[model samples]
Target: MKIAIIGTGYVGIVSGTCFSEFGHEVVCIDKDAAKVAALCQGQIPIYEPGLADMVAKNMTGGRLHFTTELSEAVPEADAVFIAVGTPSSRRGDGYADLSYLYQAAKDLAPHLTGYTVVVDKSTVPVGTARQVARVISETNPTADFDMASNPEFLREGAAINDFMRPDRVVIGVENEKAATVLREIYNALYLIETPIVITGIETAELIKYAANAFLAVKISFINEMANICEAVGADAIALAKGIGLDGRIGKKFLHPGPGYGGSCFPKDTVALLRTVQEHGVSARIVEAAVEVNAAQKARMVKKIRDALGGSETGLTIGVLGLTFKPETDDMRESPALTILPALIEKGAKVVAHDPQGMREAAKLLPDSVIYVENPYEVCLGADAIILMTEWNQYRALDFKRVLATMNKPVFVDLRNVYEPNKMRAIGFEYHGNGRGHEKR
Candidate 1:
């Protein structure tokens, strides 16, 4: 199978590389000359575990190729996947901007040779697959192509594994031929008994947003429970475990944290809320989840400030991690976005460190917050330390070193990395999530 993956962003690159690994001749087309050149030279822009190795392996085997010309690449391909970015509209309507998708449809229309399955691999709105089909029909009246919505559910850190062995593959297609092509494309995973859910375009589109919204709701629910546990002197972690043990509640995304923030959850939740509002139904729970997550980020500032005995003015605060979650360089909608600003407003200078997010974080964060190379480096000369993202390094830190490095040995573990007694033994004040000031 020859596949042309348009838009060489995270999804496109990962999908194209995986397809090539599956023995398809994949041509990844992107408009950015620098990015295409970088990919051609084995320089991957995004950091996903196992992605570079997969890309390298495919490229070396001559199954994968990168190009800046879609006009040249799209014609020879049997399947053209529009994996472009559909970022949230700036107007805050929660609608994804379909400009890129429409452009790709128009561009690929004239070159649609035979029965080409044009897949909308990007996270798009419900009617987007129809819109793409309509655009293709209008541009090239004789083009024989079927548009399908195949939304990706891969997390940033574990993208390659997710692609290699997805729990299920949902493909929305109108014709039998189109469905057959999709099945063949995913045949490698099919042998492993990965369920292939064939649904309508609208349902498939909704599936992505609905899945993300549910995860966001779960995180927010646990976060709210953490707050209640703090007030009632109960442990949120234990409560989560107790509830999660039930077969109905199978424990995943149940960990209480600062908030749910990344590329997907926040944006998708807002998008779902917008979609429901347009349909005259209020998605109250999801709306509350979004609100709670936002408030949670702001609340983290107060948590750190209280740990330092109420004032942050002229204090040096250390942030152990800056990424939204561990094992990825993505900082989009990270809690640090809100918490760091609050720290700066209160006259506290922040020093942050992450295993991989520093380069990206440097652009978003102010210069006042120094980007350190190591977690222990962030702890040095700090009045109080806050664990923002629970990276593996932050989880198993030398507590003695952390205490020795800081001017004041105060640890505010937002991810509950350590217990109070453990920090106390190391001669440092510790604050775990859902644990009050009495422990500090």
Candidate 2:
């Protein structure tokens, strides 16, 4: 199968590479010439685990290619995938910027020589499939291609693995022809019993956002429980474990932390809420989830302030982990973004460290933040240390060394990495989410 992937961003690049790996001859087309040039040199623009190796291998094997021109790829391909970014609008409405999608439809529609499958691999609104169909029809009135919505659900850190073996492959098509092409394209996964959910175009679009929003709601719910646990001296971990063991409540996305961040959850949840509002119906649960997530970030700042005995003046705060989650270099909407500035505004100097997110974080954080190489480097001469993201490296630290280096050995464990009693026993003041301080 020859596939043309429009927009070589995260979804497009990863999907193109993975599709090529699945034995399809794929040409990834991006409007950005510099990005296309970088891809030509085997330079992966994004930092996703195991993606570079796959991209290089597929490109080397002649199964994958990259280009800046749509005409070069679209005319020769059997399928065209719109994997472009659909970032949220400023009004917090569920509307996405469809300029690129529309442009790609117009540009490719005129060049469609045969029956081509136009798939929407981007996370779009419910009626976007109809809009895409309209654009393609207007561009080439007699074009024989059919539009299908196949939304992607790949997580940033574990994208490759998820793509290689997804739980399900959803296909929303208007006809048997479009469905057959998608079914054949995903034939590799079909053998593994990966359920192929067949639905309407609108349902498929909403499914992606609904799935993300539900997960976000789960995390926010646990965080809300963590707040209640703090007031009642109950342990959130124990409660999560108890609830998670139930067959109905499976043990995923139950960990109580600062809040859900990165690119998907926040954006998807807000988009879903906007969709609901546009229909004049209130999505109360989702609205509360969004509100609680915002409050959770603010609460983390207060925890740090209280740990430092209420004054941040002339203090050096050590922040460990700048990425939203570990194993990926994505810092969009990371809790550290919310907490770091508050510390800086209160006259405290922040030194932060992450295994791979420093470059992205530098852009978002203030110039006052000293980007350190090691976790211990940030802890040196710090008044208090905060674990913003739970990177595995920070899990096991030389507590003695950290305590020796810090002016005040106050540890604000936002991810609940350490036992409060254990930290207290080790002669360090410890504070964790939903866990009160150990009595002196």
Candidate 3:
């Protein structure tokens, strides 16, 4: 199948490249000429675990292409996918700003030459497919195309494996014609007995939000549990393991951290709330999840402050990671953003290090925070050390060397990477989330 993906961002580029790997000719189109140029030179815009290598391989194999102009690929393709951004409307609001998706629909509408399936590959609202259909129909009344909704379920770090061998392939199609084309496009997966769920458009759209919201609820529930564990002298890890071994509640997003973030849960939960409100329905569980997530982040700030002996004023703190999670350089809504800024505002000087997030973090974090190349360098002259994001490097740090470099041996493990008893044996005052701490 000849595929044209109308956005070269994370979802678009990864989906397009993976499609090409399935022996389908795919062209990823983006409005940003600089990004397109970089991709053409085998330079990836974002850092995913194995995306660059896969993109480079597929491009070399002459199956994947990148371009800035939509006109160059849209009319020649059998399917066109809209994979643009739909960020939150504002900081506090959860409404999805669908301007980009609508623009993609409008831009590609005029170039629809024949029977083509215009698929919604973005994590859009329930009626977004209908809106895209309306926009395309209003723009080009004579064009014949079928609209399908195919939401992606790719985790950021392990997106490649998720795409190659997914749990299921969902396609919301109105007719057999559209469904057949989508199935043929996913022929490789279909051959491997991947369950292709064909449903109505709205059900497919709702599935993505439902899945994300449920996971968000689970994460918030555990974080809330962690708070309970902290207050009651219990351990979150043991608690999680005890319940996660159950076949029903399988352990996936059970690790309680600085709340859920990074391009999916936060936005999707908010969007789901907005959608529920629009329909005049109650989403109390999701609303509580959102509230718990915010409270968790604030609680982390309080934890750090208390660990500093009541105040963060005039202290040098070492921060381990900046990205939301490990193996990815995405800092959007990272816990460090909230914690560091609050501490900096309270007059604490911070030195931070991450394997890949420093460049992006520097743009968002305040100037009071110093970024260094080496993780241990962040520990130099530090009063306390914070393991913010659990990157691989921070997990196996030499505690003796770390203690030698720091001014005061205050180890605050927000990710709970190291055990409290072990840190005590090593002679450092360690603080862990949800672990019974002797000190503040």
Candidate 4:
């Protein structure tokens, strides 16, 4: 199969590279000349584990290509995937801005030379596939193409593995021909007996939003439980483990923390809520999840302030991890972005460290944040240390060193990365989320 991916962002780059690795010819298209030139020189713009090497290998194998011109790849491809961005609207209404998606459809319509599947690989609103089809038909009357909704389910940190070994492959098509083309494109997964869900365009689109919104709700639910545990002197970890073993809850996303934040959850929940409300339906649970997530971040700020003895003024705090999660450099909606600024506003200076996120975090976080090369550097001369993101490096720290360097021996474990009793025994005033009942 010859595939033309219409964007070279995270999703597009990973999908195209994985598809090429699947023994298909893939050409990734981008409007940015510099990005295309960089990709041609094997310089990947985004960071994902094993992505650079995979892209390089596929390019060396002559199975993958990059270009700035759509006409160069679109006409000869069997599938032209519209993997462009559909970020939340700037109007603050929680609606997704689909201008890029619609424009990609219009641009690719004129270059269609044969029967091709115009797959919507971006996470979009329910009726977006239909709108894309309408845009393409209006742009080029003679275009021979069929619209399909094949929304990606890739997690940012583990996108390549997720794409290569997805639990299921969804193909939303109006006819057998379009479905067949997509199945062939994903034949690598098909051979390994991955479940292929066939559905209508709207259902497929809704699936992506629904899955993300549900996961966001789960995270919020656990965070809410964690808050309740803290109030009643209960242990959140024990509670999560108790319920998670019930076979239905199954323990993913049950770990409580500052809140759920990343490229997907924050915007998707709001967008899902907005979509339902626009259709005269109410998604009260999702609305509450959004509210809870915001409140959770605020609660974290309060947690830090309380740990600092009722105020953050004139405090020097050490922060570990800035990205929403580890193994990826995305800081789109990281909880640190919200929590750190509030502390800074209250006259606290923050020194932060993340293995892969400092460069990007420096741009989103306030300039008052001091980025450090080593994790332990954050602990030097600090009033307290907060574990903001649960990166592997922060999992095990030499507490003696931390205790020796800090002006005050206070530790706030936002990710619940440490046991409260053990830290206290080590002579540091430790604060962990929802561990009020731990033996002290």
User: Top TM-score: which candidate number?
Assistant: 4
247-353 per-residue lDDT for model 2 (tens digits):
99888998989998988888888878777878898878888999999999999888789889998989999999999999889998999999889889989999989
CA shift at 227, candidate 3, in angstroms?
Answer: 0.7
Residue 94, candidate 1: Cα error in Å is 2.3
lDDT of 3 by residue, 1-440 (tens): 89999998889988999999999999999999988999999999898988999999999999999998888899989999999999888666778989999999999999999999999999988999999999999999999999999999988888999999999988999999999999999999989999999999999999999999999999999999888889988888888898999999988778878888899999999999989899999899999999999999999999989888999899999999999988889998888888899999999999999999999999999977798999889999999999999988787889989999999999999888897888988889898888754433
CA RMSD per model (angstroms) = 1.3, 1.4, 1.3, 0.9
Q: Each model's TM-score?
A: 0.98, 0.97, 0.98, 0.99
Off by over 4 Å in 2: 90-94, 436-440
Better of 2 and 4 by TM-score: 4
Candidate 3 weakest lDDT stretch, 10 residues: 431-440
User: All candidates' lDDT scores?
Assistant: 0.89, 0.89, 0.91, 0.92
Candidate 1 TM-score, true structure as reference: 0.98
Which ranges in model 4 have alpha carbons more than 4 Å from their true place? Answer: none
Question: Which parts of model 3 are misplaced by more than 4 Å?
Answer: 437-440
**C-alpha lDDT (0 to 100) for residue 242 of candidate 2:** 92
